[model samples]
Target: MTLDARSLIKAYFAEGTLPGLPDGHFIGGRIVANSDGDRLESYDPGNGQAFARFGAGKGEDVSRAVEAAQQGLAAWRDTPPATRCQVLNRAAALIRERSDYFAVVEAVDSGKTLAEARGDARSCIRLFEYYAGIADKLEGRSIPLGSGLTSWTEREPVGITAQIIPWNYPSSTFVRGVAPALAAGCAVVAKPAETTPFTALLLAQWLHEAGVPAGAVNVVTGLGSDAGAPLVRHPSIAHVTFTGSVATGVGVMQAVAPNVTQLTLELGGKSPLVALADCDVDKAVEGALWAIFSNAGQICSAGSRLVVERSIHAEMMEKLVARTRTLKLGHGLKDPDVGAINSRQHLDRIARHVEAARGRGCSILTGGSATHDPASNSGWFFEPTIIDNLAPSDPAIQQEIFGPVLSVQVVDGEEEALAMANATEFALVAGIYTGDIGKALRLARSIDAGQVTINDYWAGGIEVPFGGNRKSGFGREKGIEGIDAYVRTKAITIRH
Candidate 1:
């Protein structure tokens, strides 16, 4: 059931439109038109013009996707582990070969710069390859037994699992969840974020082409209420892996409470980038700039809060502000250093936070307002902003402003800097820049984040486990630890 996906992918990017896009759900190993005739138009974030219309899945469609997954679970779960791993390898190869095509479409679809989108596509490929190695190694342990008794364990799939994705970095996030789930032999019902379903659907199709059984991979796209909620609440779903806002994660928890289904949530964060007095100013400046500005600062683990020691604060601020002002903003297709925000609403959200900071008498060191492309004058764009003032309680410092904005807060010493870093309720990932190994280790251990880095912001990839601490959400994703949520252990014993 291989699709002419290459042609479809090529056609859209070539023409800069989606009229030829598959306007349907990818179910039962192929494209499926919606049960109802309702459709929703997707806009190009670069220009804010409607580019394509896709099917709007309702509750019934969600049921259909679940049913399809249930039908395929047995065969997929029972397949030899080596064969399963091979299929994953093949899928990764396919994506890697067409990586450029994916990059262009991702940039256009998600309003990310071409360079950023390429990194995301590459992340997806590497994640698939990393998970493929673990498929055949899901082994259990033999227990010590006395005399005539023998005991051991077996890891078994948890039937149908639902993976709800987020719009930002959709391609990478989709593979992050699904690759591990599939490697563990679980059939999946995937709900890509409504606005960014293109890459996920195309990736699912490639999985099918790589020998996944029809229905083993399903994607239902539409509004969250219509498709995502129903999929989350679907009683038959054995496990759920969701990535989004904390408020929505709570709703998902309440929905799955009655079923007692297992859940893994990766909620957003207001993560910190702490620079100590001993840290290299150049490295700290570069790390801070990248940690907040990449992906237009839409990443859940973005270093939105910059906590700096008072002694080096002014010097570091001068250097950071100098570089940040030089960043170029334009359409994603143009591969600018910074691209458009995902939507007008998101632009407004970024603006409100900046305006609130100004109202609080914070010094707007650089950008502090929403502006359009200086050339086209169209699209949702926000100037890269840096706000500096007092108070750890400022909303701009405390909240996850998923935009290209950095709140630079000055702290007295190491203790105050670390205190401010952990003051926020959200603890996902944090970065501490310092020259002292002892100090780095101490701060890394003291930070409340699930993962911490010294001198670098994003130092790890698919190899290390990542998640969050406290309100940032929990359950690890990536690495071998990621597959645990998709399977259950069964103990067996024999007595003679």
Candidate 2:
């Protein structure tokens, strides 16, 4: 069913705030009805038209949020693991109940295709469910110490955490960042990117209905400087989890210094997808296109660099260009496929990268531009771009463009392919496309990335941990390892 603008807005906010949720409360549990009233408009990326407006808050807002989180932390921590699991299970149910509204809000707010937005909204439900199952399963081992002393270890919440999520994958990233922290008994003050706060706020409303303690999960919407920084720098915050650009991550790291708070940063990537000669060229091209253009390549682990063996580079490039040209770019709210960029700034950034690559002798195969049609350019939209023949060392190749532009290069052999893949300093993820299982496994192990995929370019499910090895930043975001990221191991000993 096609959702018009009026119907979409009605579906999200409905007649008013989510039923039974406090009129003006932070997701983390603060009541701010009289607190300085301010709001920001969320726009439709397809046409730059405003769809909805969310409240804007500052230090006063931060204090209210932290207080609410602080108030609820002890009870939540003391709650039975089984109880927490039940709460999360119900939260997942509530989210699923409202998935359509979330999909609509997410699609318009972030310019993601409606189908993609629905997938993300569903993924959010899965994340909550997955973490719910693991909530009661967080266990620590008993370490043997030879003596009359008895010793064991317990994994405890590290107190309140301030999670700052990015614009891309708003539903997935926000929940993925928040759910595990909640499962581990930590209250969260999440600051989602200003441009895409609707889904996060909607999730917050769902959590409230699911019986999460009033302040267990708080979301404050505003600029990163005011809202994001305050949350990170707050003295009461025990941990800071962030997902965004390397530049911003570095800044956050610097700001949180002296406090020595625990940090889990999932930063930028210029991930490479290496296609071996023996792999199917058509399939490899398809995989590469999806890897780089999904969410318009705003993903941190986008395989933006395509490294093909020289023996098949030319043929693969032909297939890649042809496949890319077939991708439809238009209003995600109405399209069956690829949609607009998240914002004007993102579209400009993609354009600049393509221009730079062209100036440096790279050839445009297809889709290297943007359009201003109301249906397509109302939001941040860039065409799926492909720049071939760029040197592996070229600035456009090494640096992250964070757009729909794909840079292709040729390598002489398997060794050369591995070498070229490692050329980029940012090593978040790498994929190997090869018919030989041994070669694929070998390269997967040897690649300097936090996660590597063999024969496929997609990052797998929640059971698999995802992060980076080098400057792509530290800390795992999924799987059992993610639980470890949210807690501190405490060893207690008693002499008998």
Candidate 3:
């Protein structure tokens, strides 16, 4: 019999006595049920079906996980760097071995295409492997002091770290934060987004199989207000790393303030993609499509604002609208070009933005509504939308829509394009596409984003640093800088 998404899902679940759902938080070493015995159902964004349930982590659960992390920190901190590298490498291997299963779970949980979910799994593996290679290389420096005195600095783990992951890219986001913390010899209390916690639970099992010490990495699943708030406020948590909206990130920062907890925030962005008249129009169009429509445009650094030179603005708009119309929309399991939005609430949010843009007299060039497939009628799907004739100050142009929506703005020249790109408060990412290498490089420099792509979007691999500037929040992830976020420096002095 031929295999479809439903068949594949059923077969995967039927193959073994895998980790059961309605899981409690992964504390100390094993799955521990919530003390209050509360449960939260996880829905499939592809069909709006509740496929699994998990114990809703609460303040009590956060406390228990924190206690476990606090108790386990010493052993993890004392573990040799070589051994830590070995463990992280093993975890990477395990993730690769179960890549198919993890990919399916991520697709079913997050509504991203199976291919995208597989990419997420691969990214998770690469993150661990990258951190493993660098685990032993986190060296300190020798400082020059008086002639008779010798001084040196050493990097050490910052104790228990609390990571609050978002649902957009659950598996990769979870590992991206946890791997570096573990590599840096810090215990982690990870809280995956409640909407997509299953893969995180499965990842916890893989970590255990990879010989991670119990309590060294824990998974807590619950609402942000309930479990996340308490974890951020918990005095025992040494550091906090959060990825979400600006409002919630602010709440996290505020909660951690009483204790002055060290923190890293990767908030939202209204990234810009500029297409110059000198660029290959086809290549620019492709880059713009991938930049905005990948993962249904839910990425934090998605190039949602399209700025094209006035000379080629009309041609570029026609090309973008035509290409967007050809994109297939369906459930993620089917590997459609555009998959369902992450959830009902998110779909509603996107709808509100589109409606507001229309109300403001912004022209909807094409696709300003939702579409549904008969096979997955319950899915929360939004059409790929292109809006034009909006001022730079328009809310739809300035705010983070976090959906498959692209706002096009015409500019007279490169200088004006750069000005419009940086006009927003967000400075997470920006992209420039031009055949003139010198002009591309110059435009890249002029853009005020933490990460800039020239002639392409998302140009770098996992080895490069990624974060944001201005309102996009601080602290870097995904490079040597990622590791530094989990560590602190101490100076040692010796007198002869």
TM-score for predicted model 1 compared with the true structure: 0.97
Give TM per candidate: 0.97, 0.94, 0.96
What overall lDDT goes with each candidate model?
Answer: 0.89, 0.82, 0.88
Tens digit of per-residue lDDT, candidate 2, span 1-496: 2444447655544442222222343645544542577777767777777765667777788888898899778778888999989999998888777676667667777888888888897888888999999899888788788889789989899999998989998879988878899899998888889888767777887787787888888888788987888889999999999999888999989988979988999998999999999998888988998999888888899989999888898888777787887877777656645878888888887888888777767788887777654443345667788888778678878889988888888888899898899998898999989999988888988889999998778858877898996789999988878877788989998888
lDDT of 1 by residue, 454-494 (tens): 89899998999999978899999998899999989999999
Better of 2 and 3 by TM-score: 3
In model 2, which regions exceed 4 Å deviation?
1-34, 373-377
Score candidate 2 by lDDT. Answer: 0.82
Clashing pairs in 1: none
* lDDT at residue 96 of model 3 (Cα atoms): 81
lDDT of 3: 0.88
Model 3, 194-261: lDDT tens digits are 89998888888788779888888888998988888898999998899999999999888889999999
- Selected candidate, larger lDDT, 2 vs 3: 3
Per-model C-alpha RMSD: 2.3, 3.0, 2.4
How many angstroms is residue 183 displaced in model 3 relative to the true structure, after the best TM-score fit?
0.8
Look at candidate 3 and give me any clashing residue pairs. Answer: 22-53
